[model samples]
Target: MAGRLVLDGGTVVTMDGVRTEYASGHVVVENGRIAAVGPGPAPAVDGAQVVDVRGCVVTPGLVNTHHHLYQWVTRGLAVDATLFEWLTTLYPVWGCIDEETVGAAATAGLGWLARTGCTTTMDHHYVFPADGGDVLGAEVEAARVVGLRFMLTRGSMDLGRSAGGLPPDHVVEGIDQILGATSEAVDRFHDPSADSMLRVGVAPCSPFSVTTQLLTEAASLARDKGVRLHTHLAETLDEDTFCRERFGCGPVDYMASLGWLGDDVWFGHGVHLDDSAIALMAATGTGVAHCPSSNARLGAGIARLRDLKDAGVPVGLGVDGAASNEASSLLEEARHALLFARARGGPQALTVRDALEVATIGGARVLGWDEQIGSLEVGKQGDVAVWRVDTLAHVDIVDRVAALVLGDRPPLELLLVAGEPVVERDRLVRVDEQQVTDASREAGRRLLVKAGVAG
Candidate 1:
């Protein structure tokens, strides 16, 4: 059911185990898997589509490990607020989202990520309005229409303002309702095949927004169904204080006591984790999705990424909520990771290659997809991103690999997922880009009016 194609003559950055770089290379794709990769034209095949990428830089397609796809509609609204203030201000507004709003936001967000060279994205959608019917389904359909691999987290929040959580009551659901709906959605959507285009995970939004009972039950359910677990942890001192005050232990200890430290679990924006917490993560093989932009934007402190990596913790990059980062560009997110790491730990903190690794292989590992989509290996999925730097910004750059992270990134020249071209020449081919833009704007306007944030 898959086609044959060849991307010939480019600077291939194969993020394999050895981190191979090919100055002038060709990658052959057959039946949705990488057939061969070497430093020349591929062997001739019958009816194969050959694409010339002579002056381009071809790398494994970028992976985004964590995001709140529905927050695109609320960008620029809570710019100056800290994490708590921002969530408090936006919770009431998010309470107004319906299926259409969620769908439009997911479509726009996925399109933006694709435009920036992402082939796989994991969305954490937790804000379920009381009457928001099938919000998870809406996002799944949007991902289908956008033509990228989708990993949707059936995120839930059970603690509300009345119960001392930040989100408004209307946006949070009862424990029974959340669990039932989450299991139902997982049964209806999760695909466990190696080449599955869709996969579903269970995520209880965060420690502050959920109850201990809910967390335990969600973890139990995820283990029962053989799915993954995700949540936000240790993003701020306030969260640490909340954990100490509420649970009489640190966030890591709280999670460990609940049996949440393992390879099948990952936490987002792990900014405030201490040395002990980092050690725990490394010991249990738990992963971290480092959202530098969102953390900096919300005044959350820098994550100890260098320390975590040195301790053998799986660290990945995330764009987080568009409302926090304001851009869903995985390349730019990589750049930010580099910049923030240097700002925090000095010039030797993170290199361009390190940042790029977090965006590619690191992300794949975080999402438990390392074997299939992270590298351009002979038997891996045919997901590649091509960027041309022949323009003025890259004219005199001797090290093109550094240019991808240090300089202005050129728009993606081409993107392929499983031998299927979804973006070519910086345009999304599966759907009208302008139409998705317009629909998202309309949805934002309607949400603004409903939340009474409109001018």
Candidate 2:
């Protein structure tokens, strides 16, 4: 077991049930769990490694509920295109990616997420080229190297353009192959322990890219394995149109018919949900991962975040894929969530604390891991993010949460996952960032070249 560590003299925001906060406090961590947290200095421990975070604001480490880590290598392409156009333009390039490229991309993406104060992240990787040897294994290894709590949804797409889907035929897989591989991924990777660092979910890409059989069967498979289910829904108007024309209903109702709405299920985007959809999601305990920046990037309408929250629907923040939202910082997503919510429903829509909650406990709830993570409560995992708010960009902001959500992104002084330091002093502790960046760049070039899109 690792030795005990104490973070002393920081403003502690314990996002517990009652939303506790301490102006000047300390947190004691032992055996990979939070032992204590309260006002003033922590009780003295004989052999504890104490970190003085006097000028910092310590909060629960941010949780990113949705992302496509493989897209790190595919950024800056189809920038001006719509969602459908973008996918069409890049599907071929993504199909050329093998295990090596995926590993590089995942490593780079996870390292960057660490530097940005994320201790837990979920990756939705749907593209699996036939020759892409163990792409899932490669990303799992990347998460291990980066030392973050990871939930990898083995996403699949079996509906090709031949079946009126968005992806090319070559990128789509057979139903039998997808279900078999998804089950294998869950069996091989998912850990159901209270303190598990890794878990796998079953995700059948989206309604537009997957058939009814895959979605229904995937939900059943996830339930059988006692794991979670995830997929894209209501992400764009085009998807709404597709669902209406093809499935004869909106995305939410169609998913409901397949028995996909439950506490164990969470959908990405959800930007086009209406009053009825929101109500149904709330009633079913289904959650939504709100990707504010990505929605704006794709010119997709902003999600009814205020409505969802008011309706008691669990809403979490997500940075989405780097291919759409190039700035993949989870911290920035909190800012965007606040701004977008206010834009849609006036200044009273979302407060700074609300934004922070969405990035932390709300995400934890969406991922169904709030019992173990997402807050600084005693006995929870010691996943904490210490932001240096004493800097020039935030020193004047009296409210720590406001400083974090409203001011410029503060430098992350430290990021801890399960009492282990994943990032310290504003840099990654587990991997070399520069090397990861270079490898990711090379992977991008190799993929484009393989697709004959680059020299």
Error of 2 at 342 (Å): 0.6
Q: Once superposed on the true structure, which residue ranges of model 1 sit more than 4 Å away at CA?
A: none
CA error at residue 382 for candidate 1, angstroms: 0.9
Off by over 4 Å in 2: none
lDDT (10s digit) by residue, model 2, range 357-383: 999999999999999999999999999
Worst 10 residues of 2 by lDDT: 1-10
**Model 1 error, position 105 (Å):** 0.6
Residue 281 local lDDT, model 2: 98
Q: What is the C-alpha lDDT of each candidate?
A: 0.91, 0.94
Local accuracy of candidate 1 as per-residue lDDT tens digits, 1-455: 25888888888899899899998899988988999998877788788888899878899999999899999999998789999999998988899999999999999999999999999999998988878888888999999999899999999999988988778778889999999988998999999998899999999999999999999999999999999999999999999999999999999999999989899999999998888999999999999999988888898999999999999999988999999989778899899899988998999999888998999999999999999998899999998899987778875677777878888978688999888888999999999999999999999999999999996
Candidate 2 lDDT (Cα, 0 to 1): 0.94
For candidate 2, the per-residue lDDT at 391 reads 90
Error of 1 at 66 (Å): 0.8
Highest-lDDT candidate:
2
Estimate the TM-score for candidate 1: 0.98
